[model samples]
Target: MPLPKPPVRRARNKEDNELLIKGMTCALIGAVVLLAPYLAKSASVQDLMRQAYLVGWFALILGCAFLGRYALRRLAAHRSAPRG
Candidate 1:
């Protein structure tokens, strides 16, 4: 009897999926920023700005973390590649 084959993984498709997720994350962040003011009642302008800044910082950090990792990987790949 023949053994079952393992699943094949594609690198390009995984990269595309990561990009789509990053874009969607940005979109959701934008929507949240736009809706923040109207969503909070009895909140002062100062409070709203503080909340927005915190939210924005969190998103920025998360996105940058992934981007930094991706950039580091590409840099390492280039460093290892032979130059003509």
Candidate 2:
């Protein structure tokens, strides 16, 4: 019997997935910021602001991490690419 063919490669790569996930993460952060006050109107506004601030920081860190990873990968690829 003939051997099976190799699996097909996907068009999307690791960086694309990372970008998608980061985007979703940031969107959730925004959603939380918008939803928190409505969900807990009785609580002090200052407390909600504090919670949103924390979420903002997390979103910032996540975006930075993704950006750094993407940059390093592209730089490595550029350095390793064959020059004509």
Candidate 3:
């Protein structure tokens, strides 16, 4: 048997704006997490470069955790919204 296609619904302006805001916030947070260590440092060019490299991985892990928590919160909020 073949699977059926799901129907598509257009979003209202408010919904679109909400999604846009969420996307922007996520991007901003991702950028900040990726830049945090360099933003914290006072060092020579070589040391900064080294720090940058190490911080990339550190920030990636941190960002993953942050994003996970963010998504989990959103999911919980979604579940709680209409039933209350």
Candidate 4:
């Protein structure tokens, strides 16, 4: 008699999902900050926004990095799975 194959587990990783959510949030915040300057009419507010432009860039880059990491992890997991 042939042996039975083990069942595959499709458990989801909470941490990975959280990371994805965080990334999305950061990206949204960064976008808002970057665009706020264009919408502001006051010179003072525009100046402040311009000064904080670097912060927006940082947040955007960080968010992209997190997203990239999540994607890489998922890809690695998929590649490591046993073939049927």
Candidate 5:
């Protein structure tokens, strides 16, 4: 049998970066939600959902913050690449 071709990589660009950040945020939040029931619940489903919402919000905010930092570092590296 012939070898299969590797999957094609998407172009790395601003739009892609935005998408990546959004995807990561969603994945992390979803993971938190899936585990919410297993976690400690105060009184009812309302409380549990409230906690989940707060946690999810923070997770996304932190993810975006780190993504922005990474972008800045990449920009700096690119600028300093040709040190002559």
Candidate 6:
């Protein structure tokens, strides 16, 4: 009897998956940083958190952009695929 063949994996698919994971991680980190001020009790800590607020926003925006790019690529690929 012949052995079962393994599933094929494409490089583009792997890269797309990586992008999705990276975007999720960045968004999670940004959310944590953005909420840090509320969790701090010390005035100095809150002040630091305020300073880091811009960084959090940047990360969140970047993550959203990455997610958007991934979605667009997927949509384009789906649209271009031939129907049976």
lDDT of 3 by residue, 1-84 (tens): 866654443453345446545655655655665565566555665465555554555555555565566566567757855442
- Full ranking by TM-score: 6, 4, 2, 1, 5, 3
1-84 per-residue lDDT for model 2 (tens digits):
977765543443565567757856775675566566766666697476656766766776676676666667667767966575
Model 3, total clashes: 0
Model 4 residue 14 lDDT?
Answer: 73
Candidate 4, 6-79: lDDT as tens digits: 56543457767877998898888788789889999999999899899989998888888889888987898799
Better of 3 and 4 by lDDT: 4
Local error of candidate 6 at residue 61 (angstroms): 0.5
TM-score of each: 0.46, 0.50, 0.38, 0.76, 0.44, 0.79
What are the runs in model 2 whose C-alpha is more than 4 Å off?
1-47
Cα error, residue 21 of model 6, in Å, equals: 1.1
What TM-score does prediction 1 earn? 0.46
Candidate number that wins on TM-score, 1 or 2: 2
Candidate 3 lowest-lDDT run of ten? 5-14
* Candidate 2: Cα lDDT at 33: 69
What shift in Å separates residue 2 of candidate 3 from its native position after superposition?
Answer: 47
RMSD, every candidate, angstroms: 8.0, 7.1, 10.2, 2.8, 11.3, 4.7
Give the Cα RMSD of candidate 1. Answer: 8.0
What is the C-alpha lDDT profile of model 5 across 11-46, one tens digit per residue?
Answer: 445555775677577657755764566675656864
lDDT of 1 by residue, 1-84 (tens): 966754544684487458557855865685566566777675795477556766766775666666666667667757966575
> What tens digits encode model 6's per-residue C-alpha lDDT throughout 1-84?
976754554988998898899888888888878998999999999899889999999898888888988899889879977575
Which pairs of residues have clashing backbones in candidate 1?
A: none
Backbone clashes in model 4, listed as residue pairs:
none
Best by TM-score: 6
Cα lDDT, model 6, residue 83: 75
User: For this target, which candidate reaches the highest lDDT against the unseen true structure?
Assistant: 6
List pairs with backbone clashes in candidate 3. none
Whole-structure CA lDDT of model 2:
0.65
